[model samples]
Target: MTTLLSVQDLAVARGLRTLEGVSFALAEGQAIILRGPNGLGKTTLLRTLAGLQPVAAGQVVHEPSALAYAGHADGLKSALSVTENLRFWAGVFGRTEVGPAIERMNLSNLAARPAHMLSAGQKRRLGLARLLVTGRKVWLLDEPTVSLDTQSVALFAGVLRDHLGAGGAALIATHIDLGLPEGRILDLTPFRADPARKAPRGDGPVGFNEAFA
Candidate 1:
């Protein structure tokens, strides 16, 4: 299987060094767990992978046309209605039929509601539903389980499993248990220990922000 994303000797620091020489390779159908304290650069790492943040050191090589990113903010336009939001994302990914994606994400009944009008968990589902439209081989998700009810979370887990089983790759930075049978791990606490290497703030109040483009 091909490596979807690779980081070698990865380091990111503005004032504090949150990750030092952190290296890993993510293959298709595989997932990795990144655990750490508050200040570590787990979010920064995902941003860098998505090419939203500049890498101070090391390298991230990714194949083009095989990337999609979702972060803690939900990234939906508040002014857009649910169907409109799905339409925009569908247009962006060039995907057909908002129907299948909506049904797959359990969002069929709420398609007409405006995003801001929805509850937190509903908003989260709206954000996640984009993944199905994305049609990307590699997914970068930051705290994907946040704001989801037990049932919705389980459904999202099933969705993720199906994505992986289809030869897709994912990197998730999460505190919630994923219930996945297998995943790799890299702790970020050690990197945050350095007082000088503080991480960035903004975009979701101390959480991962996987910005693409």
Candidate 2:
């Protein structure tokens, strides 16, 4: 399989607190489960890989627009209906199909409901649905199973499997089991930064390669 992303001797900083060394490569159709104790930079690592945050050092190489990220904050407009929210994401990702994504997440029945009216689980379902329209080759998800019921989690696992089947790779930072027994686990604990380090000078713009370093 083709390599989708490569990370070499990465150092991700959270306000001058640099994380421990990190290095890994994601090949097409592969999935890596990020495992580590809280405060060990699991979320930081995901944000870095998503390009939402910058890396302090090391190199991250991938094709432009090849990544899609879902973080702790569900990027949704409360006033928008479920369908409208998905429509907006589809437009942003240059995709024309919103029905399949909605259906995939089992949100068809809630399509007309305002986002604010949905329960926590429903909102999470919607968040996961957004990933479908991006057409990105790599998925960087942080705690994707949060608020999802068992059935919803199953659905998510199925979606992930399908993505891999289509040659997409994922780096998921989650504490819960996503039902991917074949997925590899990446422990971030070994790369945890020292607490005594001084804070960095300035916060940089968040992006794919620049997030964690």
Top candidate (lDDT): 2
TM-score of 1: 0.87
Clashes of 2: 13
What are the per-model C-alpha RMSD values against the true structure? 3.8, 3.1
How many clashing pairs per prediction, in order? 7, 13
Index of the highest-TM-score prediction: 2
TM-score of each: 0.87, 0.92
- Tens-place lDDT digits, model 2, residues 1-213: 899999998877778655757899999989999988787778777777776666777788998888898887778889999999988888988888899999999999999999999999999999889999889989998888899999999999999999998999999988778777558998877777777875456645453432111
Off by over 4 Å in 2: 204-213
Worst 10 residues of 1 by lDDT: 202-211
